[model samples]
Target: MATVILVRHGRTAANVQGVLAGRTAGVGLDAVGREQARRTAERLSVVPLSGVVSSPLERCRQTSRILVARQEHAPGTQVDAALTECDYGTWQGRSLGDLAAEPLWSVVQTQPSAAVFPGGESLRAMQARAVAAVRRHDAAFEAQHGPGAVWAAVSHGDVIKSVLADALGMHLDLFQRLGVGPASISVVRYGPHRPDVIATNTEFGDLAWLGALGPVADAPVGGGAGHGAPRADEPAARKLAP
Candidate 1:
């Protein structure tokens, strides 16, 4: 199967304001969010993408456009409803601090599988549809562009977390353990045997090695000389910009 890059949309006013934007219309990326997307684009410009799919929200569409703009091949972009934000229903536009006081908040924090927004979708249902959508697109890209093809999916935080949890073989209830910050990138490749999680919640790093990735085989013994040794003056891993 093809490799899929899961990109969470950059920050928005709702994010800065600590409010749940949910599927509310017209919620687009703010200034910092646009800059974050641009930085993400710079990181991804080294690799060629087969396509870019985004949630049908302004934030994700804007991020997708920025990403495609920096792509070496300028992959086409499209919208996928399945990749949209979780339907927070009554929770939409509510302050996070206020929602934290609701009884359901504890359930959402402790066991998301059983958490369902009032008049909205269940967390389990969200994971199911998102996993299905990602796998479907992975298969389509693999068939159309071959196994080495790469693609991007620009979506919401919770949506991407659920997809990552599924890819990691973690249960829905444990998905909250993962943290996906604004504009963070996660990489996954579906194989015949299992899905390989190449990276998760990455904000800074050189991704040019992705262009040279081989077939999705079993993990190399002893980690197999990862991405090559760093240069003498370089740190073993990149430090997040302050």
Candidate 2:
């Protein structure tokens, strides 16, 4: 098992303009986005992350760079195709206001399981691939590092939300209930038995508590994790996975 920190890239020009920048190439982070990236980097710097992976999108890559730069010994961000933005097909670069008027918008919101972006993939496809990708990366890192390994994936809002919904054992259609803001952090502890949703859509927090135990420099293994949370135990979390 491993703890996966899911981060949505900072706001982009498209985000500011309410455009669906889906897989539209060259759309980088805007000014506000840079600031969010910097703050997120500073906030996550305390944790000894084993690896950083990101979607193969420029905005996500930009956000990943800021985070990797602040880490003491984090591996450079790996651009995983699995983490790419949902292929919105004809919807790419379209305005949100325009999409809102479309008949399928309601299906997307109320029954995402049935949503298929015109000329693109279905929501169920997006959920399956994103979940598998994150799970694969999480298990691999933990196997290489140890039971207590941690990593982060910088991805799109819907992708992260779908993953969280699965972790919470909620249906894909209910995923809209989960939110992921730009540069926000959502954590999940994936175990052999089940997954735990640690936090969701949080903008800021001093993760000093992350360094409070096991393989963490200041605190020794077996020491309790501070900030009122229990220690992170892979084997123990696995017992709850089912």
Top candidate (lDDT): 1
Clashes of 2: 3
In order, the Cα lDDT scores of the candidates are 0.91, 0.87
Name the regions of candidate 1 deviating beyond 4 angstroms: 228-242
Candidate 2 achieves a global lDDT of 0.87
Best by TM-score: 1
lDDT of 1 at 161: 95
Query: Per-residue error at 71 for model 1, in Å?
Result: 1.6
TM-score of each: 0.93, 0.88
Residues 12-37, candidate 2: write the lDDT tens digits.
99998999999999999999999999
Backbone Cα, N, C clashes tallied per candidate? 0, 3
> How much is the lDDT of residue 107 in candidate 2?
99
